[model samples]
Target: MSEQSKSPQAPDRTPRVVIAGAGMAGVQTAVALREQGWRGAITLLGDEPHQPYDRPPLSKAVLLGKADGATLDVDFPGLGIDLRLGCRATALRPADRLVETDQGPVRYDYAVLATGAAPVRLPGTEGLSGVHLLRTLDDAERLRPELAGRRRIVVVGAGWIGAEFATAAREAGCEVTVVEAADRPLAGALPPEVARYMAGWYGDAGAELRTGVAVASVAPGAVTLADGTVLPADTVVVGIGARPATAWLAGSGVALSPVDGSVLADERLHTSVPGVYAVGDCASFPSARYGTRLLVHHWDNALQGPRAVAENIARGEAEGVVYDPVPYFWSEQFGRFVQYAGYHGDADELVWRGDPAGAAWSVLWLRRADGPDAVAGAGRLVALLAVGRPRDLAQGRRLIERGALLDRERAADATVPLKAAVR
Candidate 1:
């Protein structure tokens, strides 16, 4: 037997494993542990009083009253995990491997830093009564009433939340305006051409798109721009960005990425410190596909990372499965169902598979001019961006990976279905 197999298994003794931040990431960790046949006692620490819930529907269905907060309740009882809700994790001491919470200090045999992230609020816009951010159930609940009447809503960022909130505001019969510092929407993720197509979406949906504008300050019923233009608004929803909630790990001997405040984890999701693993939005791991340390904050990543960590923690290693996903995210905004799978960083060419002027459309991003036949990374198809046709995304993803040469003329022709062009 290998030395690892011969080593005596760690005494179970109902090993107490403590997880902080009871969002999707935290709850998924506990559930994944049980699924991995881990017999350790699991305790979840969260700042919210409610049980673990899904967060994506908050700005969309929840705000529309079609969905309620309770609908997001995760079945933790079914997984045999003790949930310590309504409490915040204050600190972590690696020297003693303990987590300090508002209730008391919980000694941990293994610690999972799934603290997730905090919504970045635009500075100089604080203390405003009507300003809101969607990070927790409380934030969503507090802003729920503001969407009732015909209110003037100003979304401070043109990213996912801003676009989604703008959509919701327009649905609520409110006038909406989106402010983005970049030239177009989703600039950080999507290419310029793709973003321009999305920019037209806000206008078509009756929401103003104030691109290349920066917020100077915010006051009651108005957002002042850098150019001194005051946009009137009854509610200001800030979705500028988010920073990883790693303040508690400041001196905890864990390596954290200084760029976005994300934790640095190896292929096993193990941190530099032994027995300390980080996952979800708090972790930046090297991706074999992207060839970079990717920090994906989507729901799928959190749901997948814990299983890898649990198996590794229990048996010292987990092969065949790691936390590298293709990176997919979907947003429902302005009556447009937007979905993008795969990353398209610095793509040189973009081909529209459908009509951008129409409600349902999709775009294929390529790194070079040749074709989707081009290999990914150096010069290949990297992302499938679809606004309405969700099925096209799946087909496009498959063709792009196999380096299939697409008929440039008919491939992007809206009249032809993507699958039909495959052969």
Candidate 2:
């Protein structure tokens, strides 16, 4: 195996950093440690036998066969990092600072949990041949053949994954039908008005969008609706939502949210247990910028959170950095590029730029203020949603980070640039 020597100034005995889960977050933590000059024995363990790869493309590019797998670009042995593939972590022993894996127990000076989230599977759909959940490379490979053939595809849930899957299926000339429990598409993520507008995108793409429809059951060659309607489907795709992958840490003394079972990590991404931290979908970190704890299950979080974890482990607590990032994610569905940045809440004032019914539009979520004078000084740009507008998202992210105040009228004007809306 290739090896890199430790720094000359460093002590002879180096600390060992163990990372659980070999996904984007886990692998990034290992690389960040080395990049930050942490000359430790980094052990990266993954349950999957395949090489570490990106998950976002699994629904779009990989599913459509436009490209192959998007694997992580890192030389494992060359970096002096031990990458143990196909090793599932069974339990966490915080007191012993060891992780119990299928292979054996692995010890570490610092442990980072980045197990990531699993796709929500439909009940009674297990063992079904045509039923699928697209989360991993293997899952995509299994569903790709179904898309290649002419088949009736029924996608459950109108979330990002479902929409993208439907888009791909339609592009492949398959008969597509999307079923959503809510009255509008993306009901959990977007407002009803915005979701209503997005619902039309399905028809535009030649896919039938059925909202307010719940799946009664899934069987061979069909999906039964709650209203006693049977939709003929050769293949069924479920993309409801995902929860944090923290079941292994049940008795590990790490604090987890009772509502969603997410690891309650601090601003520094540290778990309740000492020398143990969590990031990515498995952990929820408090954000002072948004005035709440955010459980971000996107690519950006997995990419950025690891840097903070490495800083705390390498530089010590006094020099540790805080991770309060403006949550960002993008989705390509129904021939539209949808982008969102920053955290939005009910208290934020909704400012619409351009027309939501039009081809291109954006929404600015300004933090609510008390009085009229507050508009000039207190109504900060908290969040932004842009459809087919990349520049708005690009500029709004920076403005949101600086807590920039905005003039309401200027922000509402579609002609004005987002940066110029600042008071």
Candidate 3:
């Protein structure tokens, strides 16, 4: 072993890897290391008492009691992994190779940070009886009763989580009122032209949507708007946004992004500290594919980032793979399947495959061939948003990965397959 990562123990002691946050990223990293032939001590830590479970279903099936919980189907005992539930990593000491936790301090040769993210609660809503945030399984369990009672719900944000919660609430026969500070839903995600069409969805689903307004205060039984308008809300759901849960990294000397508090990982998913890597919602990685650093908080990132981290850790540093991926994520809301892929740029051209008002349509973001940045993947497919069109998403995602150039005229034809439009 190199003098850098060598521990204080004798040379023959087995190597140990400590993983914090037992979400998909942490669990997959532990399993991937084993799969990649790392037969050493692996310790997985989680703050929650329940076994490692999925988060997406907490807003859908679990809220409606259609399923108990989205528990992952990994056999930790069979794999010889030490999985510790309800043990949260308080701080990381890279210099000593020790992770300080509530249970105790644990030493390791390598560590992975996958602490994920925490939801952004509305200001002044804390400890309010009816205020709620739907990020964890417990939060969903707390909300199931309210939905079962058919309570009037006012969702704070119009982002992805808010839309999904509204969908679930509408399905459960509860009155849902979504209020957005922006003028339209998904304002931060999509441009005004694209997101305008989604405004109709809330009304069509029998939910009330109030846009271009801010919430002034939250009471036990009502919400006061900034415009002196008061909304009667039996149960308030906050879905504004979420930030990376990296507060424990403070004073750890790990380089974190000033913009979002995400661990600034390099191309190999390695953090500023030696022998330490960050993945999933807690880290932001430099993306050569998009010429930017991206902090992706979607399930696909959690699923994909760990594999690269595992391969790099299992293999030597010289053989480490670069962690650039065409990002993808999907959501079912308002009875429409919404899928998005790749990272869109400000200068990219937008092309419509079908009418946005129609049930099935797609919007593709492409770079121009004659643009000044032609050398760096200009004229290539950069990003796409597919609504009620799975085939378009499947094909567009592959095209984005390949950096395929497309014929604009052919791409505009909704009937033509995306692959056929490739130049």
Positional deviation of residue 344's Cα in model 2 after best superposition, in angstroms: 0.9
User: Best to worst by TM-score, what's the order?
Assistant: 3, 2, 1
- Cα deviation at 286, candidate 1, in Å, is 1.0
Tens-digit per-residue lDDT, 1-423, candidate 2: 111223436533457898999999999999999988898799998999999999999999899899789898999999999999999888999887788887777777899999999888899888898899989999999888899996899999999999999999999999999999999888888887678889999999999999997999998999999999999999999999999999999899999999888999999999999999899989999999888889998999999999999999999878999999999999999889999999888767888899999989999899866765555434689999999999999999999999999888988998999899888
For residues 137-192, write the lDDT of model 1, one tens digit per residue.
Answer: 78888777888867888888898888888888888888888999999998888877
List lDDT for all candidates, in order: 0.79, 0.90, 0.92
TM-score of each: 0.89, 0.95, 0.96
Q: What's the residue-level lDDT of 4 in candidate 1?
A: 23
| RMSD of each predicted structure | 5.6, 3.7, 3.5
Q: Candidate 1 — which residues are off by over 4 angstroms?
A: 1-13, 70-73, 318-320, 367-380, 398-410, 413-423
Worst 10 residues of 2 by lDDT: 1-10
Candidate 1 TM-score, true structure as reference: 0.89
Poorly placed runs, candidate 3 (over 4 Å) = 1-12, 371-378
